[model samples]
Target: MTAQTTDTVLYRGEDYDLIGLIAAEPITPQDFGMTPAMISTACYRGYFCTYAIEDDRLFLVEMTLRERDGRYLPIGGIQPVADAREATCSYKDLRIPVDYTGSLRLASGFVRECYIHMGYQKASAFETVLDFSLDAGRIVRVHDRSAEAARKRGAFKKHFEENVAWGIQESFDLDMDIW
Candidate 1:
């Protein structure tokens, strides 16, 4: 859709459903850590899923909940964003970590993982895995290769990325606190 179009799916989320949530903000070039010309916005919906567009690309962060007075509070802004320290994979040169407790799962039973930070020297990375079927080509042999931190990190990233993504998409309990 054109940026000027009023009807759009990629909205900044400032409607009635997003009243209490934080509105999308500009992610300046400095926010991306490379160029000073790139720009994006951090948008929220019903206190969930903060995302932005940087140079026409969609970027998201991992969301986590912290216990506060018997309640779980979201840590990475209104929607979830990725944390660099949580998990990572070795396949990529930069080794982007998985967002939101490591990994997220999809309704199709596919696992999705994210890594790297927006502020990193390079673009972030993502992976999709198929765990339910042996025929799926996404499966990797990590049990023995995960001796290094990178291998272990990649495996964990895939595992949880699938779970969280699935939970969010299905509205069920792979991850409850964030979705």
Candidate 2:
């Protein structure tokens, strides 16, 4: 939501125009799977800047990423249900990548999940836990218990169960390079 202007002038007895580049929206909703249920909020934002010249033009490009995390409740508005009908599991504080601010043609999305170990260096201590991409969605029934640890072996133990909401949670955008 910033302003940019171009100027035209005669330099060295030569006439020329300096046309500024077009500004594009940096975020959008579709980047995430779910739509805005009720007012959406941006959970996080990141930006990368570069100063470079190309084709005799000075350019300042920025890459930005935004996250939207919020969900709806069931009927009473206090609790959350997948839908008003209560068919699917209710989600809370869903996170989605915001693609509303950038060019619709160059948006990107992805998800990654990994485990986190709670206790290490001790035989009795619990270790290894599953960690999902928060920007991807919400999860439930995921926990790390000592008994579950005993059942599993290897460097990966500390077991936990989880589910995803598939709601819009996070996203990133980058400027296209000509070269």
Choose the strongest candidate by TM-score: 1
In model 2, which regions exceed 4 Å deviation? 1-136, 155-179
How would you encode candidate 2's per-residue C-alpha lDDT over 105-152 as one tens digit per residue? 111010112222221111111232211111211222223233443344
| TM-score, every prediction | 0.16, 0.14
State in Å the error of residue 72, model 1.
20
In terms of lDDT, the poorest run of 10 residues in model 1 is: 1-10
How many clashes in each structure?
27, 26
**Span of 10 residues, lowest total lDDT, candidate 2:** 103-112
True-vs-predicted CA distance for residue 63, candidate 1, Å: 11
Cα lDDT tens digits for candidate 1, 54-96: 2323344322221112233232223223334532111111111
